[model samples]
Structure formats: structure tokens, C-alpha cells
Target chain A: MMDRRRGLGRYGLSLLRFWSVSLAAQMEYQLNLIIEVVASIATLAGGLFTLSLFYAHGQRLGGWSWEEALVVLGLSTFLDGFSSTLLRPNLGELVKQVQNGSLDFVLLKPIDSQFWVSLRNWSPWGMPEMALGFGLVLVGLVRSGARPGPGGVLAALLLWACGVAILYSLWFILAATSIWFVKVWNATEVLRSLVGVGRYPISAYPPALRLLFTAVVPIAFLTNVPAEALLGRTTPFWCAASAGLALVALICSRLLWRMALRHYTSASS
Target chain B: MNHQRSPAPEPTTRPLQRIPMRRSPLRIARTLLVSQYALMVEFRAEIVLWALSGVMPLLMYAVWSGAPAGAAAGVNPQQFARYFLAALVARQFTVVWVIYAFEEDNLLGRLSPLLLQPLPLAWRYWAAHLAEQATRLPLVAAMVLLFVAAVPAAAPPLDPMRLLLALLALHLGFCLNFLMQYAITMLCFWNERVSALERLQAIPQLFLSGLLAPLELFPEPLRAVALHTPFPAIIYLPAQLAAGGPIAIGPAFLNLFGWLALLLPLNLLLWRAGVRRYAALGA
Candidate 1:
């Protein structure tokens, strides 16, 4: 037990060091911070404008009220920001490491390769978007008159955690494929574009696409399910299913990474 | 022969300044197209992934078709599908990556070598974009056929004249987009990271360019304002024309030319200033 505790403590300390170094390096470009803030604001405003178009003329998309849909949009925006902060920086580095055989040094380290590779980089540019997304969610809850109790809030947080796990697993899985297809850099772009559809409630899509997003991509869990939880409208079944899917996805990503390493002959070998 | 003789006579203590032979514009264009196309074909796999990333409009169609707004706006599901499919094609053809390319080359100091060539650097990027569009054609055609096969009712009857006109609008739209982005790319001479500015430009392009939903669905004031911007001329007008939707051809062409007239001079000015600035910075 003491050994396990030390291991956990070491990982925590390593994460802190990793993020601080990257933050310092990134802070050299002060203008980038302002650009990121403005770009995120513009993006959120444009998203709100598009969302408002659906609600114009007294229409609800797939039976989702305006405020309810706002929650989904907020969640989507938050996930996008999260991706920009964590998933993109680390996974992009992973692809580079694979191309140049720097991953060999990573494997030689005393820590878990997956954990080190996945959590080694963080960008502060996504902070404003994340805050704005949380603000929107609160506004949506107040406007929609859905006051979640303590238990409801806990459930919502848990489901959101599940959503983040699933999202990370999905990205890591795709990034792992770079080990085989070294030039599959743009594959992540395709995934990002597909995830853009999650801005609306799953029901807003046609039945066919609804099924595809839910089953094939699990985008429904990424935004809709968590939004439903926030609104105090989620069922126990969905909560359980979301947790299950998140677990399955996380496991799959781990297994795939392990399998991919076996195939990694190192660059120019 | 006159040029050769003059150059031979100038062989003195100083090195001769050879005046390049005047080549036909057509020949120059053909050579640029062929060489760039060959380069593009080598990266066909990455190009295919890039083509698939343009599935935004198609996804929007799936939502809009089922939404009540389509019915309220007097556009049925079939029209939504047709419009978005055409939008997908329009966006595929008009996509510009000049800013990304230019920023990279400028920062890596590759632009100095490119500028040393006799050809204007803009034509190289333009030829590359045209070649990429050519590479994308077969893949986009396959996607369209698959969509039409899945939903036959979404297929509109092809009008020969409108088709020709839509082709013209599409190419003009590509030129306008290229110029606008190339203009933005010139800022790389001053800023190391101009892609952030390009991201800002893309926000308006996304909301206003009829990529998310048809511009017809936007409220009156917004739609009118959007039409005035250069965004709609890039996607909305050409897509609407190709989809057989009602649009005034003359006014649409006028809009394209108007923007072209404004941007062409702006690009030329920026190019001259940027190159001078670049030289100073490099020195």
C-alpha cells in the first residue's frame, strides 16, 4: 500500500512539473493569450447565433427547449476547449514522437508511457472557453428553471467525468493509430469535424444519424447525456450506460496503445 | 534571336544581365498546373482525409432536414439535402490553406528561396490550390453519388446553362477566397503567428457562409447583412446556383466582381509592402 501511495504521489508531482514547464514556454508569446481569448469569444458568440436560428419562429429542435439545448451547446464548447488544452497538445506531440523516434526515450522512462504521453502538455488558451462554457451552463439552468439538488449535481459531475474519459479515450485511440499510419495527422481533424455535430441534442438529428452518433461515435454521451443530467432529467439507465461505455472506451484505448507499441519498430529502423 | 544577340554583346567585364525570353501566358499556366498537380498526387491519402473533413454541411443537412425550420422557411427536406450537398462540394472546391502554407514558409525562412524564382510566389500557391481541387474532384464526385444513391429525391435536374454559370461562380468564388486568404497571409511578414487571425476570420465565415444552415433560414436583417459580406459569395451563391435554387445571376456575378475589384488591389498592395518588409527583417 505504501508503494502504491508513493507511485501515485510521484505521478502527481510529475504532472505538476510537466504543466508548469509548458506554461512557462507558452507564456513567452503574450499576444497568443489575447488572440486565444478573442477567438474563443467570437466562436462562442457565433455558436449562440447559430443556435438562436433554430429557436426562431417558435421552433424547438427535436423537442429540446431553447435552454435545454443551450446546456448541450455549453457542454460541447467545454469539450472543445478541453480538447484544445489537453488532447490536442499531447496527442500532437505523440504523433511527432512517433515520426522522429523520440517515443523510444519516453518508453525508457520509469513511468507509464501512456500516462506520460497523454498528460505531459497543457495549454492555458482553453481556459476562457471553459469558463464561458460553464457560465453558459449555469445561465441555461437558471433560465430553464431546473434547480438540481445536491444528489443531482453529483450525478451530473459523475456523468461529465465519464464524458471526459470517453472523449480522451477516443482521441488517444486515434492518436495511437499514428504508430501505423505515420502520416495520419489529419485523421484527428475528421474526428473533430464529426464531434462538431454534438453541439445540438442528439434528438435534433434524424433517427438514422441519431443512432450513428450514439452507437458508432458515442457523441451523445459526450454532450447530450451530461446535459440531460445537468437539467435533472436523466434516467438511471442512461447514467449506467454512460459509465459503462466510458469504461469500455478507456480500456479499449489502453489495449490499443499496448498493441500498437508492439508494432512500433521505431522511426527509420 | 534579338534577345540572344543582345545578351552575347553584353558579355564584358561585368556579368551579363540576361533578359528572360517572353513565354506565352498559356504555356506558363499549363506548366504550373502540371507540376503542382504532380506534387499533389503524391499526397493523395492526406488529401482524401482533408476532403472527408468537409462533412460539416452534410451533417448540418441531416439536422436541418428534420428540423421544423426547413418547413417554416418553405424549404422541404429534399431541398435541404440538395442545398447542403452542393454546399459540401462548394466548400470542398473553395477551401484555402494559403495562410497556413505561407506562415510556415515565412517563419522557416523558405520564402526567401521561393522569392528568388522568376515566377511570382502567389501563382505557385494558386496552382497548388487548383491542383488540390483537381485531386479532390473524383473523391467528392464519389461522395455525391453515394449521397444521391442513398436519397434519390435529393437529386436536382441538371440545367445546362445554370450548370455552366454555377461552374463560373464556383471558380470565381475560389479566386476570391484565395485572394482574401493570401491577403491575410501577407501579415506573416509582421506577425510570426498569423494563423490566429485566420481563425478569427473563419468564425464569421462559418456563421455567415451558409455552411451550417441555408442563408435563407437566417432572419431578414442578418441574411441581408450576410449577403453583403464576401463570405456568402464564396459558398452560398455558388452552392445555391448549383442546387437549382432561385438566385439572381446578374446580381450574384456583380457581387463577385465587386469583391474581386476591391480585393485584387488590396492584395497587390500588401504583397509589395510585405516583400519589402520581409527583406528588411531578413537582413
Candidate 2:
């Protein structure tokens, strides 16, 4: 029992040190950090602008009202902010490392390669996006004209946690693909399109599309499903379904990740 | 004189004539395409990824069309129809495939092989892109036509003559885009992180190039800026022509030609200066 605790302590401390180094790298560039912040804000504004264009004519889009759609769009933007801030920079850099045959050095280290690769570069620039996302959620709460009651906010957080999980799984799967297909930047653009689709009310799509959202892409969980919970439009079934889907996707993604590592071709080739 | 130099020369013995009747330009282009195809075959998965990435415009179009049935913000549902289909076609047509070309050229420093050839390096690059067009054209056309068939109301008139003009405009637009990217890519000769520059430059092409929505849909100052910018004449102008608008064919081409002529010279100069700097520093 004493040995187990000592091992756990070392693991926790190394993780903290890794995160600190990642944060240091991210904060090194003052100007790039500012540009990243502005770009995220611009992206959010672009989403709102598109939403406003729809609202200019009617009270609703397809079947969604202004408040509900706002929540959805806001949630989508917030989710996207996290995706870019956390996942994108590291993955983009990893692609470069793979292409240059530098990934072997990374694997030689004692730490878990995936854990180090994914968590190695925490962008201090991401702080602004996190803050902005939180701010947007608050604005969305106000815009929905309903004080986000504790239960609803709790539900939103739970759903959001699931949403972020879905994104992590999605990215891990893509990264896993990189273990076999080293040059994989081309497919990364698809990730952007997937998130872009989440910027508006999913109701604009037909039932077939909704099925696609739920099953194939799980895009609805990433944004609209959670936003629905916040706006009181979510059914109990949706919350339960999203959570289950998130769990399953996460589990499979981890399995795939392990299999990928087992098959990882050291870049020495 | 060379004809006379051959021993046992006969009628029609000139080696140039005996060779295939292919034009020099045709031969150069063919060689470029064949080599490019060979590379593409090696990385077949990347090609599929590129084809799949074009789906972004489709997503944006669907959401924008979700606007209320009537005119919303000066664009009717019908206009939105022409706008998106045109954008799709434009996106497919204007793809310069900077990824493969830049990756190999910069990372490997293998551009010297192409430069040593008689062909202008630019033509070789264009030739590879053209082969991609040849490979994908039939499918892309079918996809666009399928969309047009779905919404006959939004179908652009099949004016063969106007389409001819649109094709010319499209070519010139592609040239301008190529030259613009060529100029910017020279920065790679100096800077190591071309990816960041590529990302920053690419964002505007999607937004400012009218890929997301028609220039007419952009808000006040933005709309005017977009109109005056050369990007719209590339995508939006062709869109007007395709929709059977009485777009003056002459003026559009004139503007396109003017920009092409100017940018072409500038790109050539940049290439010369870039090569000098590249050689001087040996990066």
C-alpha cells in the first residue's frame, strides 16, 4: 500500500511538471498570443453574425427559437475555442514532428508517449479562450431570458464535460490514425468542418441529418444537445443518451489509441 | 543544317518531324502531369483527404440557406442557391494544391530539379494542378449538376457563350490566386514557420474570396471592400455570369487580364529575388 501511494505521488508530480513546461512554451510569445485571442474572438463574432442574419427575418430557424439557437451557437463556439486552444496546436505540431522523423525521440522518454504528446504543449494562450467561452455561456444564459437555475447549469456542465470528452475522443482517434498514416494533415481540415457545422441550430437539418449528428459524427452532443439542456429544450433521454455515447466513444478511442501505440512504427524508418 | 548532318538521311528523316507530332507545350505539360500523377499514386490517401476537405463550403452553405424563406438581408433564398453552388464550383476550380507543392519544395529543397528544366517552374506547378482537375473534373461536374437538378429553380442558365467567358475569368482568377500565393510563399525562403503564414493567409481566402457567402451578403464596408478586391471577380463574377445576369463579359475579362498581367510580372520578379536570396544563404 505504501509503495502504491509513492508511485502515484511520482506520477502526479511529473504530470504537474509537464504541464508547467507546456505552459511556459505557450506564454513565450506575447504577440502570437494576442493574435490567437483576437482570432478566437473574431471566430465567435462570425458565428453570431451568421446567427443574426438568420434571426433578422424570423423568430426561429427551422424549429429552434432565438434563445435556444443562441445557446446552441454559443455552446458550439465555446467548444470550438477549447478544441483549438488545447487540441489543435499540439496536434498540428505533432504532424510536423512525424513528418520530420522527430517522434522517435519523444517515444524514447519514460513517460507515456500519448500523454506527453497530447498534454506536452498546453497553450497559456488557451486561457483567454476558456475565459471567453465561459463569458459566452453567461451571455447565453442572459440571452435565453431565463436565469440559469442551478440544476440547468449543472446539467449544462455535465453535458459540456461530455462534449469535451467527445472532442478528445475524436482527436485521439485522428492522432491514432497518425500512428499508421504519418502524413495526415490533409484530413485534419475535416475536424474544422465538423465543428463549423455545429455553429447553428441542428433543427435546420432534416431527421436524416439529425440521425447523422447523433450517430455517425456525434456533432449534436458537441454543441446543440448540451445547449438544449441549458435552454430547457433537452429531453431526459437526450442527456442520458449523450452521456452514454460519450462514454462509449471515449472507451473505444482509448482502446484504439493503445492498439495504435502497439503498432506504432518508430520513425527511424 | 542539322537535317543535312544525318548519314543515310531520307525523305522525312528530320528527327524532330519523325518524333511524335506533340507540341512542345503539350509535351512539357504531359511530362509534368505524368510525374505528378506518379507521386499522387504513391500517396493515394492524401488525395482522398484533399477531396474530402472540400466539404466545408457545403456546411456553410446549408446553414446560410436556413435563413427565412423570403429575402433576408437583401439575399433571397433563390440567390442563396446560386451563391452556394457557384461557390462550390469555384472552390473546386481554384484549388492550387499548395500543400503538396510547398511541402516537397520547401522541406526537401527539391525545387532545383524543376527549375533546371526548360519549363517555367510555375507552368510545371500549374500542370500538376491541372492533372488533378482532369482526374476530378468529371465527378465534380456530376456533383454540381446533381445539386442543380435537385433545385431546378436555382439552376443558372446554360449560356454556353457566357460560360465560355466564365471559364476565361476562372482561369485568370486562378492565375491571380497562384501569383498571390507564390509571392507570399517566397517568405518561406526566409522564415521557417511557413505553416503559420499559410494558415493566416488561407483564412482570408475562405472569407474574403466569397467562399463562405456571396460578397453581396457581406455587411456594408466589408461588402464594398470585397467587391473592389480581385477575389470576387474570381468567384462572385463567375457566379453572376452563371446565373444568366447580363454581366458585361468584356469588362470582367479586361479587369482579370489587367490584374493577371501585373501580378505575373511581380511574381516572376519575386521568384528571381527569392532564388538569389535562397542561394546566397543556402537554406
Against the true structure, whose lDDT is highest? 1
What does each candidate score in C-alpha RMSD?
3.7, 5.2
**Residue B14 in candidate 2, Cα distance off native in Å:** 19
Complex DockQ per candidate: 0.77, 0.38
lDDT of 1 by residue, B1-283 (tens): 1233445555468876767778777888888999999999999999999899999998888888888867987888878888888899999999999999888887788889999988889999999999999999999999999999988866865888777877888899999989989888988888878888898888899889889988888899988888889998888888888888867678778888999999999999998999899889878
Question: How displaced is residue A54 in candidate 2, in Å?
Answer: 2.2
lDDT digits (tens) for residues A110-216 of candidate 1 = 88999999999999998889988888999898999999999899999999999999999989999999999987779999989988988998898878888999999
- Measured against the true structure, the TM-scores of the candidates, in listed sequence, are 0.94, 0.83
TM-score of chain A of 1: 0.97
lDDT tens digits, residue span B1-283, model 2: 1133324455774664343434466655667788876765676567666666776656665666665622556666667777677767777777775544765687787866656766567776777777776666766777777877876656776779877877777777777777777777766667644555555556556666767666555668776665656676667677666766434566566666777788788888877887788678764
Model 2 clash pairs? none
**Model 2 chain B lDDT-worst window of ten:** B1-10
